[model samples]
Every structure is written in structure tokens, then in C-alpha cells.
Target: MDELARRSFVAAVLGAVFFGGPAVAQNTTAGGVTRVALKGYDPVSYFTDGVPQQGSAEFTFAFDDTTYWFKSAEHRTTFAADPEHYAPQFDGFCAVLLSRGRKVEADPEAWTINNGKLYVFSGKRGVLSFNERPIDIAQRAGENLKQLR
Candidate 1:
């Protein structure tokens, strides 16, 4: 890899190790299945409010076998109406890492909205790398996601 690519790879690995692992959308169980998506951050708020807002247990919705919380019932209703629109790309994994063919958990606070789509990052490094070439990274991430599926 080139020097920049090598540095980015290292950053992603370190971020994953220090921060967290790949986030599986589903956290299943025998008693019950409840996986709070985006670490309980209201996905809709990322768009409507332009920031990450902690969700409430009182307003939760289940979609694609994963549970999501909302800051309010209105946000929940908005999400229920059209979930795919508000949901993060790469199933909430770090977008930059996804573009590089890695599955790493993303921090909701380290995120960006591009072309009307929300993309989260492992940290500031990932976000900076993504901002360098968003269209290309997003395209690569989309292709990687398709291959993974």
C-alpha cells in the first residue's frame, strides 16, 4: 500500500482495537431478541436534528430484525414511515473502513451526511479520510457491502 493508505489502515486498526469491534445489527437471544441499533442513538435525529441524540426506551422500533430507539414518538413514527432513508450506510459500520474492505464499529458522534445519506466513522481519522474522497469511498463501501452480502 502507499504511505497514506498504510497510515489509514493503521489508524483504522488501532481505532477498532481501542474503540470497539464490528457492530452486528442483530443481537439475538433465546429469551428475547433486542439489539439497540447505533448504540441507542436516534437515527432520525441525525438527519432532522443534525446531531446524534440519545434515544429513549419509551420510543423504540424494530426494523430488519434490529431494535432502534428514538428521542420521541414523532421521530419513531418518522423512522417507521421510511427506515432505509434514515439508516446509516454500511449497516452503521465505519464508512472509511468499509471502503477499505474492513468491518469496524463506528461512533455515531463521528459521522457525516453526504448526498442525503448518513455515514458514521470509527473516529476523527476515518471522518477525515472519508472527507478526502467521499464519492469514491462511498462507492467502494457500497460495492464491499454488496460483496459481503
Candidate 2:
């Protein structure tokens, strides 16, 4: 198999062995009203502040059918200008799990910026796994995301 395909297979096997099965689906919306992205963490903070900051409801914006909270009005404006640039990949789902074709919720605190894009993970393991072979995992995750959509 090619390198990407080989990594994908290994990821799937590891996921099965470690997680015992497919990851649980993430909840997109609460009360079917507002869908909070990044669990209320400001997406912009990952890039600008270099840390995850809890956002205030006072500064919120809706994009791609999800409501994103911001640390400040300026951050909200920045996100509104180009949401795709700020939003986490895999719809805020765990990047490592997505490479394994699983849709799992991500922890905003566990994240990284690769190629100027934001990627969030489920926890420490997810972060470490993604860091190992980011390009391969990201490519695989992108393909899996298309299938999921």
C-alpha cells in the first residue's frame, strides 16, 4: 500500500485496539437551537493568543450552521470575515479519530496548527497521534470527511 494508505490502515487498527470500536458521534447542537462550535472556546485564540480561551456569549457569530463564541468582539469580527480560515477541521471533531473514519468530539485545549489551519483532538493521545504523521493523517481525514458528508 502507499504511505498514506498504509498510515490509514495502521490508524484504523490502532483505533480499534485502543478504543475498542468506532468513536461515538459528536453532538452538533444543543436543544436543537444553537450549535456551539469548539465547546464555546474561541477559535481565533488558537492562532492569535496561542491558547484556548473561553468565549463569551456576548461575542458570538453563526457560520456553517454552527454558532461560534469569541473572546472579544474583535475576534468575532475576524471569524466572521473568513470563518473557514478559523474553524477547526473535521467540524471540530477529533482529527486523529477522523483519520480512522470516526466522528469524535474534540477538546479545544488539545489542539495544533498545521499549515495555517486549526486542528483539535480528543485528548493527549489524539494530539500525540496526529503529531506523529500529520500530513498523512490530515490527508486521510480529509478523504474520510468527504465520505462522511
Candidate 3:
């Protein structure tokens, strides 16, 4: 098959195996629409406010079929300018789990900004584990991500 077709086939297979639903569900919860990204927490606020601020549906944007809410028009504009810079690492998956070559749901409230990258954890333990060695865990997760991607 052609390269494009082969890649599409592989992506489809991976999406089915990993997500068990539409590929867009990788960003949302079970491919549902009401499930907002980062659990409705403003992505920009994590940096600008140094905390997780709940966002409103009024200021929102949809990317990759997942909705991202913002606290204000300014924050929404900032996120629109460059979402990759503000979005949670590993697509909001538990960073510590990813470091161990696993995929687990993350708790938006349990997170940290390390080296300008936002990492969410499944719980307090995952946060502490990731904190123990951010660089090392990041390296390990990077290695795993290569194969997964």
C-alpha cells in the first residue's frame, strides 16, 4: 500500500486498540462532547495565575474535537495563539504513568509545571513520584512516547 494509506491503517488500528472509539476520544473522555479538556480548567491560568482556575463555557475553542475552556477572553486568546505551549503534557494523561510506559487518566487538579511543560498526575502519589525526578521521568516518558507515537 501507499505510505499515506499504510499510515492511516496503522492509526486506525492504534485508535481502535488504545481508545476503543473515535480517535478524537484520545483528547476527550470516551468521545463525549460535554467532557471539556483539563476538566474545564483554564490552560493559560496554570501559567499566568500559578494555579488551576475553573473556566467558563462562554470562552472556549475546539481543537482535535476536544473543547478547551478559558477563564477570560484574554486567556482564551492566549491559548488560541499557541495551544501546544499551554496544553497539558501527554494530552493530559498521567505523566508519571506515561513515564513508566503506561496510559492512565489524570486528575487535572494534581499537576505541576516542570521546565515549562505541564504534567498532570492520576493522584497525589503520581505527582510526588514525578517530582522525585522530573528530568529522569521526562526522559523515560520521551522514550516511551516514541514507540507509542
Candidate 4:
């Protein structure tokens, strides 16, 4: 297979294993248009301005066949306004691993926020593990992300 094809195929497999769905669901706004969360329920719109916007500003990357939206237009306007507060770490990756100085793809449903930073995990179970060591996980993830780049 060609390089791009190989990459696409790998991405597909990884997405399926990590995201837990072949077709990710798009979380919509109160108006019920545009996509958010890729396949999970974020509800940031309701929290921010009682409405969801077109997209998130932190990292606009397509995931699980859908686009992930942000907290509000303010998120887009500033691009750094509470980034850790809104942006999913490690591109929506597993939080526990982040805390362990590693990065792994996560299931959208498994999520939590600490110090305003959004953390995603492989599943509810992983989240539990993360909860057990929030500070350590946060510190490790912060240090590990630099190496990933």
C-alpha cells in the first residue's frame, strides 16, 4: 500500500479502537445544527452561552467522522481563552496515560476537567484510575506532551 493509504488505514483502525464508534455522533447546539464532540456529549455550549458554536479554536481537527465544537464564539475569538479549560488534551487522548507521562487515544465519553484542563480517557474505567491520581497525571501529561511534539 502507498504511504498515504497506509496512514489512512492505520488512522481508521486507531480511530475505531479509540473512539468506540464507526460513525462518531455530532453533538449539536440548541439550534440543532453544526457538529460537536465528534461522537460525545460536551455540553460546553450550554455552560458557556447557552448555545454551541460552529467549531472549537484550540485544535480544529476532524475526529471520528465528525467535527468537534468548542465552548463558545469567545473560544474561537481568543484561541487561548481558557484553552486548558476547553481543549481536550493529547487530541482527546487518555488522561491516565497523560498523567503517566504517556499519550494514548481516548474514548470521548471518558472525560474530566482539572484546573480547567479537559482530560479524556479510554473509558470510564480509565477515568477512575485518573481520578485516583489527578495531580500526578496532570504533571506527567504536561511534561510528556513536550516530547510528543
Candidate 5:
């Protein structure tokens, strides 16, 4: 195989084995669970109601190999209009864990929206640590996500 093709093949294999699937597989984590981003929470609610509202499968949209639930057709439309703007950072994985270069399940109830970005936590500890140093941790998490994506 040619060098470029070989490099791409190797990268694809390594990414799938180490980081789930392709870089667009941001909805998934390293643990191999094709996690539904925000865990069925209504992404629009965070902006509209300022809370994490449970979403219904009836109002859903599929993106990046993951299904996102919404509270209403309006919410679904809103999300579909601009998923990147609404989707959680690091595919809804714990922001704190991402900062530490780890992938873990997130607790929907434990969330934060910093500068129009949604970030969820795996647990209370994640929330605490993220809150303690949000800027630095978020920066590190952003860098880590760049590599993952």
C-alpha cells in the first residue's frame, strides 16, 4: 500500500480500537458504548428552561450515529438546525474526566453550561472538580477532545 493510504488505514484501525470508531464517532466513548448524547436529556431545555429535562423518544433526531431525544418537535427542530452548537462537549462524557484524559459515563443531572457550551459530569466529584477550576479543566478537556475528534 502507498504511504498515505497505509497511514490512514493504520490511523483508522488504531482509532477504532483505542477510541471507539471514527473521529466522527464523537457520540461514543473509549469504553465502546455507543452512548446517546446527553443520555436522552432534552438539549434545548438547558437553554430554554435552564434545566436538564428528560426527553422523549417520540421527539428525536439522529446525528453522528447517535440518537438525540427532545421534549418537543420544536426542540427537535432546534437541535437539528444546529446540533454542534447544542451538543454537549466531548459527546456528553464527563467534562472533568475528559480533562484528565479519561472517558466515562456522565450523570445527566450533573451538568454545566459555560459560554454556551454544555458539559456533563460523571458524578458529583466531577462537578465539584470542574466547578473548582472550570477554565483550566475545560481548556484541557477541549485539547483532549481535539485529539479525539
Candidate 6:
């Protein structure tokens, strides 16, 4: 294979092992069972590809950490141009918890998106619990965030 192809192949393998599938390939069954699992925090950070960009209808940060290969400088630049439109809510924390007067970190394994908003949880257990009644959890979370500020 050519050099570029070889490099891409290597990158893809590493990506699957480390970052899981492409950001779009993330699993949302429940219990934060995403491909990767983050340390110091829940697995959702790994599943959602490390939060999303808010505001401008994008999904990634402008200046993403080099840990994940974003594919282009322009992609990063676009994220930088207007981050509020792209940054994930609560830095990829558990949206349910955030709306519920708490600040629980997320596990990348359990994740989902509703109307462009990413919701992450601790793991398969967490995802299943959240899925039992997403609306109620979401509503409570919304009320909780309102009290924060």
C-alpha cells in the first residue's frame, strides 16, 4: 500500500482501540456502554467522543485535544471559530444529573443524543436506569440546572 494509505490504516486501527469508532458510530443502547472508557471520569466522555460543541450546530470542539485524530486543520478551525455552538453541555458530564441538582461525571459507554444534545452516563447500568424514563430525568435535570445559576 502507499504511504498515506498505510498511515491511515494504522490510524484507523488505533482509533478503534483507543477512541472507539468514529464519533458517529457511538453506541447508545444504555449503561454508558460506549467503545472507550475514560479515567478520572465516567465512560460517556469516551463514548460521545469527549463532549460536543454547542451553539452553531456542530458536534466537536474547535481545538480538540490531539488524543483523537480529527482529520483536518479546517475541522479544528471550524470548531474554534464558534465553540459555543459546538461545545458539549457540561463538558460531557451526565446531562440527567446536571438537570437534577447534581454534577456526576459520565461514562463514555452509556450515551445518547436527542435533538442534537448529547447525554452521557456512567455505564450500561446508568444508561438503563436513565432510559427507564428519560423525559422525567431530563425534566428534573433541566430544573436542577436552572437552580445552578
Sorted on lDDT, highest at the top, how do the candidates line up?
2, 1, 5, 3, 4, 6
| Full-model lDDT, candidate 3 | 0.73
* Cα lDDT tens digits for candidate 6, 39-146: 222212322355432221122221111122233434434433333343344445577677567866666556766555556775666567667887777777767755
What TM-score does each of the candidates earn? 0.73, 0.75, 0.69, 0.49, 0.70, 0.43
Q: Which is the winner by lDDT between candidate 4 and candidate 5?
A: 5
Clashes of 5: 0
Query: Could you tell me the lDDT of residue 125 within candidate 6?
Result: 67
Best by TM-score: 2
Order of all candidates by TM-score, from best down to worst?
Answer: 2, 1, 5, 3, 4, 6
Global CA lDDT computed for model 4:
0.53
Model 5, TM vs. native: 0.70
Candidate 4: RMSD to truth: 12.3
Please give the distance, in angstroms, between residue 144's alpha carbon in candidate 3 and its true position after superposition: 3.6
Any idea what lDDT model 5 has? Answer: 0.74
Tell me the RMSD of model 1 versus the true structure.
13.8
Q: After superposition, how far is residue 93 of candidate 3 from its true place, in Å?
A: 0.8
Candidate 3 C-alpha lDDT tens digits along 19-114: 544322123455453556688888889899998999887776544345678888778667655666888877677778888899776888999998
lDDT (Cα, 0-100) at 147 in candidate 2: 90
Per-residue C-alpha lDDT of model 2 across residues 72-143, encoded as one tens digit per residue: 877866775566799998778888999999988788899999889999998978888988999999999999
- Runs with alpha carbons beyond 4 Å of true place in candidate 2: 1-33
For residues 28-127, could you state the per-residue lDDT of candidate 1 as single tens digits? 5356766666888999999999889999887766554456788987787677566668888887888898888987778889999988888999998888
Report, for every candidate in turn, its global Cα lDDT versus the true structure: 0.76, 0.78, 0.73, 0.53, 0.74, 0.46
TM-score of 2: 0.75
- Per-model C-alpha RMSD: 13.8, 14.2, 8.9, 12.3, 9.2, 14.5
Model 6 is weakest, by summed lDDT over 10 consecutive residues, at: 60-69
Of 1 and 3, the candidate ahead on TM-score is 1
